[model samples]
Target: LPATLFSATVQTPWAGIVAQSPLVLVLTGAMWITYAAIYFLATSVFKRTPQDAAVLSLTVALPNYAALGLPILGSVLGEGASTSLSVAVSIACGSVLMTPFCLLILEREKARAAGENSGSTLAMLPVLMWRSVKKPIVWGPLLGVVLSAIGIKMPDLLLASIKPLGLAATAAALLNT
Candidate 1:
């Protein structure tokens, strides 16, 4: 949908999101809780086979940041909208932010599939969380968020310089990809 229409629909709540800290944290927490439940249930409850479970888990677990997320937020939040920028930071928190967690799960599943003991069995989750927390994708967006929250306005000259560069870069990346 177009940004204008999306703005007309979501502007009130989106504005409130940007306006407060506790609300933001609550929303973020709710999102993660939802994701965890979906991922766990996708793997545990619904799958008839291991591969089915893996695929299910991955599908629910993966964030299609570059696809559904970025464009949708960009459209909804409109040009130069801070909330859009905020969502941009999150959407760009792509698999890089998540690969380690994926890897850790895959490791345990592989061990179980191979009928080998993972020794302590409990180390898996902490390791996965640690890896995810330490990842660059997780932290990079946080830095962007901090800058944005501080109202760091880009200068006209800087923005002008970056705009075409962004367009060209996107076109090039799309073509190459």
Candidate 2:
């Protein structure tokens, strides 16, 4: 997933997309609000466990934009549209902001289920954060962003080799979805 994210990031004109502040804000805001709504509803109204609520919310909120949105939009809009940027921004926001929250909840749940003496949420925060940071899904786009910001490019050979795996990841994700 990180490889896919890195590839998408390096390929997309993120700077140009980000320059359109309204698009960025709207996309980011919409995703976050959707996630929050589902999560709170699941936990409060539906009486789901935090772990279940987190998973349910993220699943419902984050779409498979790369597999579905990019191909369809590119085909219909004829390649030069802002669609790729929109998809990339959506993917980045979902991976960076939403995934970690789900991971943190899942990690806490895992520790609890295993009968580990995990402390209070505040005490567990550092460990949870470190675990989240180490995930490829979390760090992949982050590394991509940093490299792009510094004007460093992935060599074509590396991209070619990783392309297959990235595509496989996309297909698997689509199938799962």
Compared with the true structure, all predictions reach lDDT values of 0.47, 0.78
Quick one: best lDDT, which candidate?
2
lDDT of 2 by residue, 1-177 (tens): 788887777665557546756866786688779989999999999999999999998888877775677667788886764776777777777777788888988887787788764678778888887888899988987777667667778899988988897778878877886
| Model 2 segments more than 4 A misplaced | 115-118
The candidate scoring highest on TM-score is 2
lDDT of 2 at 41: 97
Model 2 TM-score?
0.87
Query: Candidate 2: lDDT of 10?
Result: 67
Clashing pairs in 2: none
Question: What TM-score against the true fold does each predicted structure earn?
Answer: 0.46, 0.87
Give the least accurate 10-residue stretch of model 2, judged by summed lDDT: 11-20
lDDT of 1 by residue, 44-146 (tens): 7774454455445545655444334445566777655565544453342323234444555665666677776456558556754565556544444443444
Q: Stretches of candidate 1 above 4 Å error? A: 1-24, 48-58, 61-63, 92-100, 113-116, 124-177
